[model samples]
Structures are given as C-alpha cells and as structure tokens.
Target chain A: MTTTTAPVRRPTDESQVSVGIAMVFLLLMAGYFLLPIYWLVVNATKSQRDLVTTNGFWFGEFQLGQNLADLFARDDGVFLRWALNSLLYAGLGAGIGTVLAAMAGYGIAKFDFRGRELLFGFALGGVLVPATALALPLFLMFAGVGLTNTFWSVFLPSIVSPFGVYLSRVYSATIPEEVLEAARVDGAGELRIFFTISVRILTPALVTVFLFQFVAVWNNFLLPLVMLQDSTLYPLTYGLFSWQSQVSRYPELQTLTIVGSLVSVIPLIITFLGLQRFWRAGLTAGSGK
Target chain B: MTQLWRRRTLAALAVAPLVALAACGGASTEPADGAAPGSADCAPTGGPVNLSFTSWVPGVEEAVTLWNQQNPDIQVKVNDVPAGNAGTYSNLFNQLKAGTAPDLSQVEYDSLSSFRLQNGLVDIAACEGVTDAQAKFVDWTWSQVQLGDDGVYAVPQDTGPMALYYRKDLFDAAGIAPPTTWDEYYQAAKTLAAADPAVKITHFPQQDANWFTGLLWQNQANLFDISGDQLSVTVDSPESRQVAEYWQKMIDEQLVATNLQGFSPDLYAAWNSGTVATWVSAAWGYSTIRDNAPDTSGKWAVAPMPQWTAGAKNAGNWGGSTTAVFAGTEHPAEAAKFALWLNTDPASLEILNKEGGLYPASSDAQSLPALSTGVEYYGGEQIFDVFKAASGEVDTDFTWGPTMTDTYRFLSDGFTAALNGQGTLTDALTAAQTQSVDSLKAQGITVGG
Candidate 1:
C-alpha cells in the first residue's frame, strides 16, 4: 500500500494581513456600539444644569444617587409602578410564551399527521408578518371586544410570539425519537414522559426562547402606546416616552429620564448574564444533532 | 400512531389558554352616550357632579383645587397630559375617537380649528353668561374663541403677543437703537455683524414655523381664508414672499444665525453668552429668558415688534391656549361650568397668572397687580406694558385653518432645507404652499390653490 502523507500548511502573509484588518473592523464595531451607551452612563450622573451646560461624554458631577431618589420620588413613585408593570409583562409573557411554543413545536416535529406541513407553513408565514403591521388591527379587534387600556391588552398580544415558535421547532428537531420511544415502552403515560424526559432535554432551548421573547416584550413600545391610555397601566418604555415629551415644559425631568434609562438597563443585563450558559448550550445542541 | 396521539394532546394544551382568555373577554362596553346635541344642559346642577379636565399647564391643579374648595357641587379633577401641543392634540383625538376623552382639554388657539372641524368640541354658546363673557377678554383673543357669530368653542385662557427682546447692553455697546421698521432691522443686522464677528443680530429658528407664521401674520399675508365651505390657501402670496425674501437676504449675508432651535440648550447657551443680540419672542418668553439666563438679568429689555411699514402698528401672536369642553362628556353642564370658571373666575385666573406664569387673555385680569408690577429681571422695567401694547395691535381678523399642524410641519421642513443652503426661502414657501394645498385636499377638504 502506498503511504500518502497530507501536506503541512502554514499561514500566508495575506492571512496575517486579513487578521490585522479583522481586528481593526472588530474595534471599530466595538466603539460604534459602546459610544452611545458610554454617553448615556456619563450623562446619567449629571444634574439638570450640568446636563445642559457641560460636555456630553464626561462626568460633570456625581448626582446619580440624587437622581435615583428623584426618579422614585417623582409623581408619588410612579416610576417604580412602571418598572413593576414591565416585569409582569415581560416575565410572565415570556414564561408562558416559551411553554406554548415548546409544546406546539414538539408536536409538529414528532408527529406525522394530516395537515402537518400546512400548519408549519402557516406558522412560517406568520413569522413573516411584522408586529407593527398587526398592531392597528389588533387594537381595533381589542377595542371591539372592550379589552383596550387593560394589562391583558398588552399581555395577550405579547404571548403570541411566532419567532419563538420557529426557534423551538428548530430546537425540537434535535431531540432523539428513540429516547421518547423507550420512555413510552416503559409504560409511562405520554404526558408523564413529556414532563419527565422531553422537558429535561429541552431545558436549554426553552431558556433561549424565553430570553428572546422576554427582550421583545420588554422593548415593545408601540402596542402599549396605542392600547393603554391610563398611565397607571404603562410599561417603562411607554412611561418614559410620556415623561420625555414633557421635558420641554418640565426641564427637571431631564435628569430623571437619563437616570431612569440607566436603572432600566440593569434587569436586562442580569437576565442576559444569568442565562448565558444555556444560550451557548442551546446554540451548539442543533449543530451537534 | 403514538407520535400522532402525543401531538394531538400537545396541540390541545397549546390552545387551551388562548381559548380560555378569549372566552373570558367580555362584551363591548361602549362609552356613555354624549348628551343629545341641542339638548345639552349647560347650567350648574345644584347637586355635586364630578368632572375630569386634562391639561399640561402647571399650577392648573392648584387653581382647580381652589375652585373645588369654594364650590363643592362642581368638583373638577385635573389630569396632566403630555406637554407637547401636537402630542396633546393627537392624544385628545384618539381619546375622542375612542369615546373616552376628558370632559375638558387644554387646546391652543392655532389648534382649535382642527378639533372644531372634527366636531370634537361641544358648542358652549348656551353656557351660562357665555354671550356676555366675550367682552371680558381682549378683543383679538375673544374673536379667536368664536366660530362665526353663533358658535362659541372655548374660553380664552392666555395670549402670546409678539415682541422683540433685545440685549440692552449689546445695543448700547454697538451704538445702535432697537429697529423701528423692517428696513432699519436689516440695516442693524449688517451693522451688528460688521462690529463683531462672534455676535449675530438675531437667530432665525428654521425649525420654528410658528415664529415664521407670526411674521407673515404681521405683514397682512392672509395665508388661509375660509368662506363657507371653500378654503383659500395663499402661503406663497406676494406679502408672504416679501417677508421671506427679506430674511433670505439676511441669511445669504450671514447676518443672522439659523442654527439653534427654540427652547433648546444651545439656544440658551447662546443667549447666556451674549452671542445672540436679539430674540423675537412672545410675551411668555419673558419669564423663560429670565429663568434660563439668571446671570444676564438686568441686561435685557423688551421692545415692540418692528413694523413692516414704518408707522404701522400691526402685530401678530404666537403661543396661547384655551380650555375647551369635549362633545363626548357625560357631564356637559358641570364640564362647561368648569371650563368657563377656570378661565373667567377671578381667583383661578389670578392663581393661573401668578403661579402658572400665563399672560392673561382676559382684559379684567390684564390689570392685575402681578402683571403690571415692574420686573426686577428686566432692569425694573414694566415689561408687561410693552406686551400690552403689542397685544392690542394684534389683527382681530387673523385665524388659523383646520390643518395648522400639518401646515407648520411642511413649513418647518422647507425652512430647514433653505437654511441648509439647498434652496432659497422663496422656494421653500412655494413648496410649502403646494404641499399644504395637496395635503388639505387629501383630507377631503375643498381647497382653492
């Protein structure tokens, strides 16, 4: 037998040049992303007068604590109420959305039933429709049913996440069919098997879907803006926008708006960091399968 | 077969919550029907009635509280909405369409026509003593609240008569006087620019269409005239072009700064640093300037707006608002009484003037000691006297059209383009004229180009 040896390859000069170019591009993107965030952080610590008179990218005075105090104290602590409303909307919306998506996706992927392809095609089409386009029609329908201006108005539409359904389908394909067959043969009920075996396997994917939906519900502004009129029902995004529109008349609210923005970003950061491991595992699961 | 069974069970679980929620959704709860059109009783009922009023004006709550304490039968609850005029109007429009609008809303004079045209406002002509109430307000302001001769739409709350606020120190240093006419104004611009490269004579806020419209209003450029159902728009008329071309000439020579937007930090900084020698503002701007530029106190003075003709006394108005009752209110009588009392009552108007810093549109309230007293910020000058003269000189025939907001937006875009050197001011006016006609037509209104 002829012994054929593979040729050993070395990095070319052009490859090194490309590495340098890639590094430059990455740094430029880093600055582009971080500059606005840096500006927000720097300005959040400033007093109203300093915000107007001082340089935008540098600290003028350390008034973050005072601003936070004012933010929670203004209008009888309405900011806290808005923050809680946001949590309720995003947290519950995402939690429930993930479960529904997981069940639907698992069903469609494992089942060979009539209209299976048609159902999946319908879901794919749903994913193509922009959320904003549905907002007006949804508002009219809700108004017709006397559901507008309620917490349910914001919560109901949020739970119907088509993108989450799509992600869960891609994830459900990675689940092993033989494992489910083995569980069924062991005399376990289907619901029991799903709860015990399938759920454990899908935990990482579920977390991924939850996080995606959570961010979406938290960032949604237009739906809440159009649906809710009672300020008490407002989420942070809508509440802050209402306050910002009055900044020209009430200039003191400028500091409150900046400080409120900084405070609002904390919950999102914690959620992202806490669930980061599952995200990575979920991403690699599909590739491995 | 097992997979199909599991899939059916899963689908049932997925749809259960949505089905439950939809089942729980109750039947439509329509808004309380508004009082019959001609039968709205606007008299105060002896028993207590609750009324909700929405406004962005500061201290309105305090004034309403005073009224509440005095008259327990007519309770008015104040809600503060967003302060932007356009935003407030849109919110009101949405609420009105949804049949959940407040009993009373704060509407500016320029925006009143839009609501009236949409029939969103209730005719308050039958309100107690509303006919005789017209004589209590300034002549020009009184005319603004009236639709033709029979329909009374709102109670005038405040007026903003145009004035020229100049830096006395700057004028003294340049050895130049405040311009009395448009010709003198241009000459002063050139002289001031030649004297100091850093200082411009004034700022022409390209984003402020209201200010530009005020100038047009002063020159007798009747941009909109409605006769019966036919609407005539003349935004690019010769009179308006004359005003635009004059400013265009000053802009070309770099005699005026067109960089700053009104009520912005940059504009405040410019004023504080004395880089802008003059500000063409309304009466309300007096307090704003004083509050913003405290260090520059006693260095400023108010002058009448420079005339288009040397001896003419014609003037224009900018920002002012009125309290109006919505047609959808269930408590029309209490709402109407509250709206009229909020503006015409002495105690409320006094508090509105003293605390809210609102220049009173009521002639009776105009002579309040708070308004006539010399302001220490203006070098102890009676600044309201200048505004008082300007207010009287405002043309009584001036009126706003139904699409004032859209028209202002078009003008702002055109002005911004011109200021950026993409076109001349005359070209911008022409563009605005064409766009305004087209937009008005699209709104299903009859328009004569």
Candidate 2:
C-alpha cells in the first residue's frame, strides 16, 4: 500500500460536514442515554408540588438535600436499609461469584478435558432461562430446606453466574495454554497458576462479569420478592416497590420515592463509569482477536 | 477498571451497615388488640403453626396488629402485598401452585367464583367470628365472599360505590351546572372544553379496563353467566358495547382527556390545580382527591354519577378488596378471628378510617357521625351522605369471570386501539372477548356453555 495512493482527507469541507454530523449524532446518542438519569436528578431536587407544576426535565428549586433528608427519615430510613441489603447481596455475590467464574472459565478454556464442551454448553443454556421462571422452584427448594426469608436464599442463587462463566471462558481462551504449562513447568500448582497468572490476563473479562452480576443482583426484584418475606432483608428494588405501592394511599411518599430512585441510581452510575473501561476493553479484546 | 473494582469492594463493605439501618425501620405489624371472648382458645392442636394472611390494603394491618397483641400463642404473620386486585390475587394462586401459599388472603367479590372453583382456600364459614357475622353486612356484599357449597372463604372489606367528583369552580368558570344525565354531562364537557381547552371535564384513561369495568357495572351488564364451573363473557351484549361506544364517543369528541390508568399522578395534580374538571370514581378515590389535591378544597364537591337513562342505576363499584385466611396458616382460629374483627369491629374501622382514610365496610360503622361529617377539604361539603346514598345503588353483582384480569386488560388495550382509530369498536370488542376467553380457558377456568 503506497502512501500516495491512500486517500488523504484532512479538514476538507465534506470532511468537516461529516464531522459536524457525527458530532450532532454523538450528542444525540449521549442525550438519549442520559435523559432518564437527568430527569431523575432534576426531579429529585423538586418537592412533590414542584414536581407536578414545573417541566419535568428542568430544575426546580434545589430541594435535593431536603428530599434526601425526608427520604432517609421515611418509615425510619428504610430506603437506606434497602440500599444496604442490595449492596450486600450484589457486592458479595458479584465479587466472589466473579472470581469463581473466572477460575472455572479459565479451566474450561485452557484445559483439554472430557465434558468441557458440555459444561460450557450447560452454562449457555442456563443463561437462556428467564430468572422469573426459576423463582418459584427456587422458593420451594429453599422453603423445603428452611432457607426461605434468610439472606442466603437470595445470596446463594445470585452466586451461580452462568453468563459470567461463559465470558470468562471466552476471555481465558486467548491466554495461550503455553503460558499455563510454562507456569506448571516452573512448579506452580493449578490453583496458584489460575490465581497469579490467568486471572491477571483475564482481568478485563473478570471485571465485566462482576459488573454484570452486580447490576443483575441489584436490579433483581421477583426472586427477592418471592424468597424474602422479612422486610429487613429486602433489596433496594423490592424496598422501593413496597414504598411505591403505598404511594397511592400516602401521597407524602411521592417525593421520597423520587429521591430514593435518584439515590439508588448514583451508585450504579459510579460503578458503570468506573468499570466501563473494563467493559469497553473486554469488548475491544473480543472483537480485536 | 481498578476504580470499578474499588467501587464493588466499597459497595460490598457498605452492605452490612445499610441492612442494619433497614432492619431498624421494620414496621413489625402484628394484629390489633382485643378479640371476641373465647375466640383465642379455638386453636386446633398442632405443631407450632406458621399460617399466613394476605391482604391488599393497609387497613388489614390494624386487624393483624390486634391479633398479634391479643393472641401471641397462635402466631399469625401477615403479608400486605403491594399489587392491585388482579395482580395480587393471581400471585396468590401462583403461590398456591408453588406450595408457598399464605394461610389467608384477600379475593375480589367478583373474582370469588374463580377462587371458589380452584378450591385452594379453606372454608372459613365454620370458623369463629364468621358464621354469626354474615347477617350484619349488606346481604349482597356477604354473597360476594360466599363460594359454592356455602363456603365463606373471605371477609368483606370496604365496598367501592361510585360517585361523581367535580371541581365546582371549574364548572362555574365554564358556565355549566353539574351534569345529571350522560347527554348533559357531554354537553357540559364540550362547553368546558370551549371555555378552556386545558380544562378537561373528565380525565379517564380510555386504555384502562377500570373505565370499562365501572361502566359495565353501572349499566348492570353481567360479564359472564356462571353455571356450575362454567363461565362466559357477555361483552357482545348491548350494555357492554354501549359502555364501550360511549367512551369511544367521548374520546372522538375530545371531551375526556386521555391519561394512563390507575390514579394518574399527573391528572391528580391537574385536578387539584382545577385543570381537570370532573372525575368519576369510587368512595375511596375521595380520600385520594382530598389528600393529593389539597389546594382544591371547597372547590370540589360530590354529585351523583351521570345516568344513562332517567331511572337506571346511577352508580357502580370501582375498586374494593377483601381479607381471606390462607389454608396454610397454623393459627386459623386466631387469623379468622382477627380478619373478622378488622372487617366488622367498629373500633378498628374507626381507627383505620381516621388514620388510613378507608371508608368503613361494616353496615353499622357507616352511620357514625364522623362518616357524615363535612370535610374541611371540600369546603365543608358533607360528601359522606352522597357516598352513602350512592353505595346502595352501586351494582354489587357483576360477574368476575376467571379471565377477569385478562378480559379487563384486553378490553383496556382494545379500547385504546379503537380510540386511536387503529381498529373499529366491534373489532376491538371481538378481539378483546376472544383473547379473554382464550386466557380464561388456558387458566383452566371453565367458561359457561
């Protein structure tokens, strides 16, 4: 390929026009993605009165602090409690579950063993089943074992991430088996090799798995709604729903629900922004290979 | 990536403290105080009972709290589920299949036939506080909770008698009096629209099956004729189509504003602001209007629902629920007793009404001076009298076929489709009826031949 034959266009009128169009399109995409979050933030700052009176997307009086204070005070700061429960469920479930999925995926991808394809296929099939369909069976199984309403009832189910396993396997497959065999030749055990070698190479995939699991568990409602009867154990989604259901009766909750919705979204935004690099990297790695 | 990992770790570390905080806010609601004498000792000998009572309203909290206080030995827990009539009841049936059935739960009077057919509930007619209390309720209301074989599976909650709530100021602004007939109501709405396009005379979500349900009930159209275990929807009937077409006309003429269903928060605000002129709602909606639309106080007043004909029944029930004991409860006696007291006891009703703003279901309790007292919110309009008179005429005998939820949802969707001119009224009705019958049969609900 000669440099002279290559089409070179820099700062031409057509190029500039295309760039302008691209900028506008990108801005629109960004707006589309951010609109709901923006509305939530702006809406959170308004009192119930302002929420109804003013345009939805624009800022009203800056009552965010008051709304948060009221939100925390509602039914004795139950919203905070729900947030805590969600964090516990999603955090531990995602953190440990991601590491396990990484190890399992690496084993399936790098190791040549009987039933490896079967195991991967099984995990893929598991992902195909809707979470709601499993809720009842999960409840009955937990009820039989006296695990219903306990934290473990939700945590145990969240720990098994089939999608996480699939991604990890695909990720670890790129880390050539030669690297692992070399580590083994150096007297590193399988567990040690998996931890100190494969995991570092698969960090991008691991982070993606963790974030997916974290969001899945955090947003999960039906499972926890069916499994946990004790209000204290409810995650943020279920807790918010409980508060929302009563809003028809108690209009005071309208502001609190909005505020609660806003606060719940903040952690997710931080998580996404922080971990988005890993997600983007994982996608690049997959497509690049 | 490291930041994401740090966030996850931080979120994980924060979980314990957050859960502890949520645990602090637990309402730990138990039954209300005081049970009828000897009702406590009626427990059947068994292992420590773990029965459940499911209800749709916070009103049942008073009863459950009372039971927990008075009868701790039996130990009945309550699940105040957060869904509407169809959603919650359907969940109950699904829970039964899942073998996680509550000991007691609420069932709609119209939906009672389906519940009865399933035989999933216990016969509480034989329980204490129920057999003798039947006569005290309005006979029609009592018959609603009664299943076949004389089994009373549910305790009656508040009745949903319909009435017209209009902003008097808005009406005066439009230079029209309160409407007494359907034609006059449309005329008033048209005049109100001309006076100010923003001031909608009535705001009903044409897409919501609730409008259809209320209209059909008001016109006394039996949705289905139930024979033995069979069910059939009468949507092809003149009255059913009449209600559908009336709503279609209202939409086409732009007299009624289109909003999403189930207590539209925006329209509620509009109503308070005097932008929405009139709303046809049940007795319970009064509480919502009074609470949410505080600024519209003396500006709002109750009137009879506009009639289709001069002598036709002028009201229809919109939303009402009942409390039933699930058969899985270990404290059946205590649960049933509590359910009864909550539904029937005047003191409990008084507390619920005062605190929760629930209209009383008990016949005697409705006569309390407080029930008739003028509300300062409505400019001292004594609406209790209006609600009380209308409650008597609200049809109490609409068939809640097994496909009740599906029918309502399909009809609601079809109504929207028709109103949007996507389909004709006949096409919409036929489609809705077909979908409803299919859904009912799928649920194993035998449609009447």
Indicate which candidate wins on lDDT. 1
TM-score of 1: 0.85
Q: After TM-score superposition, what is the CA distance of residue B446 in candidate 1 from its true location, in Å?
A: 2.1
Q: Using TM-score as the measure, which candidate wins?
A: 1
lDDT of 2 by residue, B278-320 (tens): 8888787776787667667688888888899965656877766
Candidate 1 per-residue lDDT, tens place, A1-289, comes to: 1111111243566656566776788889999999988989999998876776677889997888899999998767889999999999999999899888888888888778999889888888889987765665576568778887789999998887777777778867877889989988999987887778887788888888899899999999867866776667888988887778766545667778888998888889999999998878866775786
Q: What is the lDDT of residue A269 in candidate 2?
A: 80
Scored by CA lDDT, what does every candidate get?
A: 0.77, 0.71
* Candidate 1 Cα outliers beyond 4 Å, as residue runs: A1-21, A112-117, A187-192, A284-289, B1-36, B39-50, B58-79, B84-88, B286-298, B346-357, B364-385
TM-score of chain A of 1: 0.91
Q: Native-vs-model 2 lDDT? A: 0.71
Residue B417, model 2: lDDT of 76
